[model samples]
Target chain A: MTTRLVEGSAVVAEAMVRAGCRFFAGYPMTPFTEVLEHMAESLPRVDGVCINAESELEAVGMVWGAAAAGARAATGSTGQGLSLMQESIAEAAMAGIGFVVLNMARGQGDYFQATRGGGHGDYRTPVLAPSGPAEVTELVADAFELAERWRNPVVVVGDYYMAHTWVDLDVAAAVPDPPPAPDWALDGSSGGTGSAKLVSPLGTTKQRDGVGYDLAAHYDHCAQRRQAMTEGIAPRAECLHTDDADVVLVAYGTMARYAEAVVTACRTEGLRLGLVRPITLWPYPSEIVAEACAETKVVAVYENNAGQMIDDVNLALLGAAPVVGINGFRTDSSAFGIAPDVTVENLTASVQALFEQYG
Target chain B: MYHRRVEREILFTGIGGQGIQLAARTLAEAAIADGRRAQLFSSYGGMMRGGNSDAFLVVADDAITSPPVVGTAWAAVVMHHEHAAGVWPKLTESSLTLINRSVVAAECRPGTGAVVEIDALDIATGLGAPVAASLVLIGALVGATGVVSADALLDSAARVLPSYRAEAAAVNRRALEAGLATTNLGHPAWSRAEVPS
Candidate 1:
């Protein structure tokens, strides 16, 4: 495959289009603006529509509308903007309307918001955190597919580093063209025919000949759908030297890339260190992590934020291993998440210290 | 220390308007155009001019594992030295650093590494393409380092340069050629040797 050097935002947009996303709506926010800009530039040429919504709430609502009408649609912003869109996201999840949600987060602070849902509900948005531009291509494609297949919102997270980093990759080769929307999608075809489809968070419309809207019944169906989603979607991860290493570093997104470099460097020095990079944050890849980290002594959780995903890693480990928490020790205090301190040198020191104390 | 496994890392720094971002991107594109894998991360401030703009790039003949933030780089390409001190400490002992003498003070040289001082602005002025100083400096870097071939750089320039600057493509080529002629390939990016596939 021929590779063209492209920014991660362009790769996401191109990959989304290649995955058949026809409708895009987003309010411009730092890190998320470029993705919207790319989508606005690309979508129109391919007979698609891109809307610059007034606010994050509007953007998510717009995507929900498009998705309800059987269009592969998406909206995005950073963690702050995502906070505003949470209510709509939960409603979409409850309604079983499928759409992709992009969070080019300021930092890794949104781990809890992404996997656990900031919106009030027991619903969970399947979260995908790609480490680099190349992986983003495949993950973006997968985001759309998972959204359509499971009929639920899927979240893809990136950060300042991942958003700006450009890599040589072929978008066409990695992502196949998306197929038509599913038959269950609403297109107003059955309207006025007494069998009109109702796509609502409260659940589908009750049949005209049957009893009125059964809210409990709707919730029962949603409960089953949630359970089915948990069973159907498989969690994924990238493991390195975890089999025999005594110290394992667990990180995701761009932080994982730096952790991988540290893991490799420590391995070169005969240090028994390894890494567990979660590709999916929602399902948490618990079983895979538990199996891969089975032989480890210390499962060090290295998240950019303060102990967000550590809980998940702890849950995944099931206390099989001693778990510790490490921050990126961010040198940039701007809170914009510019972690120059996230270099391999700093991380290697941190990981080596774990080996020194625990190994 | 066995740093930089299969890739060569290059760091670029300059003021906001010096075209450091474009130059770094062009160099990366040129590397890919010449059949190498490249990764670049550019950070810039809000100011349109005179703000800090730094870029970290890695080019490899195979899959690249080095993170975008390199603790030590193989080289540094500096357009202005005001913001280059941060990168100077990150340069290795054998690193090849290029400073645009036209704007940067000679005393701003890195503590380690061989320094090549070029009158990039002067060269661009001589070529009548005054805005092409960054391109000239990058071209001279490729000429000296062989990070990418001059021809590939020219092709990448044609592809990446804005449409409004299309008329200046020939001048860019001339500027690149002039910069290339300034250096003799003393250091060829890790002995100019082939990597094991």
Candidate 2:
């Protein structure tokens, strides 16, 4: 296998292509822009179509159209751009459209936006928050698989760190086993036949000649599918020193790496600090979070934003442990702009102060 | 010096046009070529000529889990005096710092790390590639730390050069060799890596 140092966005796009993502459309946004750039360059080379849509709304609509036509498709933007696509995303979820939506976010401000979305309905999308470039490479294929498996939009959340960083990766290694076929997709083969299919935001009814609208039944089916996903897709997480530790720090995305390193260093210095990094942010990794917090005294939820994911952490713990929210948001005075102060030293100080009072 | 399974962070700092990002990338790619894990991050301002530009690189034998912004760098390559002030404070006492004597007017604090000042611009100009002063310092980085072999660095540098700029490849090679000849690898403050048991 040939190893090459590559930008994370380029590698992630390659992995998506390998995982059978044949259609991509996105608008330019910082951090997320790189992914779109790579997709535009590489997708057409693989006999796939990549579009630089006029806006985020157009991008998601394009991806929805592509997914409806039986191609594994994707679209993404920064969290700000994602806000504009919420209606389309919710529609896709309700309609059982399977595709990947990437939130190459600016920071961890959008945990609630990704997990508990603004979509108006009893709908939830599986969100994967990868901590670094390597994880992004691995999760791209899994995101696609999970999307198709549930026939719902799967959101992969990352930030500037994951986007701009260059790491050594072999994109080939990231392609998981091919997902099952989309037999239910819209193909124009049986257009005139009575058995011709219909794909819509309204759930399909057993009527070929008449327009059947069954709101109550469709809602029931959507609820049931969401329930099945909750049970079938086990939450994925990484636990370090959680089994026997006094304190457990809950973090995700790029902030998770900062916490991980600080935990290792704290352990070296005899603090008994551990970390719980939720790889799959929704499904929320509640079970793993609960398990890691079982024996710990204090659970610190560190996020780059102003205390978003702490709610999920608190809900997961179910008052099993006291939770403290550590806000680590920081903005660099550069053209690169704002980001979290996700340095190991900064995190270590936060941990030490927490221990000084609560140890 | 170098030890396997441990993370080493290097910060490259200079003005916007100084090739700081490329130098950091070269070290990172060289480490990867030698079967090591590496991550390179670049943060720069909007100004294309004279603004603070920096790049952070983490090299490790195993996966590097550190955030893009490092707390304390193990090593640093300073290319200009303009942005060096802010960089000095982020370094720990044991940081292995190399300054471009051709540009930086004052030396770093005497007690901080093992400071190696090289006239990189002068060296590069003598080799007929003054713009490749960054490569010269990168060569000194390999020589001082032995993090990766000089040959590995040269190969990576050649590979990373854009196709349109291929004409300067020979001079860039010469600059790296000259920088290597100027530095003595002994008395390195940074830990050298060996395969872990």
TM-score of chain B of each: 0.92, 0.90
- Give per-residue CA lDDT, model 1, range A1-359, as digits (tens): 66788888888888788878999999998789999999999898788999999998899999999999889999989988999999999999889998999989877888888888788776878999999787887898899988988889999998888878898876454334457767767886775656887889887887466767788888888888989999898999989998898998899988888888888778778998888899999888999889988988899888887788999888988899999998846645335577766778877888878878887
Lowest lDDT 10-residue stretch of candidate 1 chain B: B188-197
lDDT of 1 at A263: 82
Every model's DockQ = 0.62, 0.61
Top lDDT: which candidate number?
Answer: 1
What lDDT tens digits, residue by residue, belong to model 2 across residues A265-325? 8887888999999999888888889988898889999888889899889889889999999
Highest-scoring model, DockQ: 1
Write the residue-wise lDDT of candidate 2 on B93-140 in tens digits.
778888888987774433477788899999998888788898899888
Which candidate's TM-score is highest?
Answer: 1
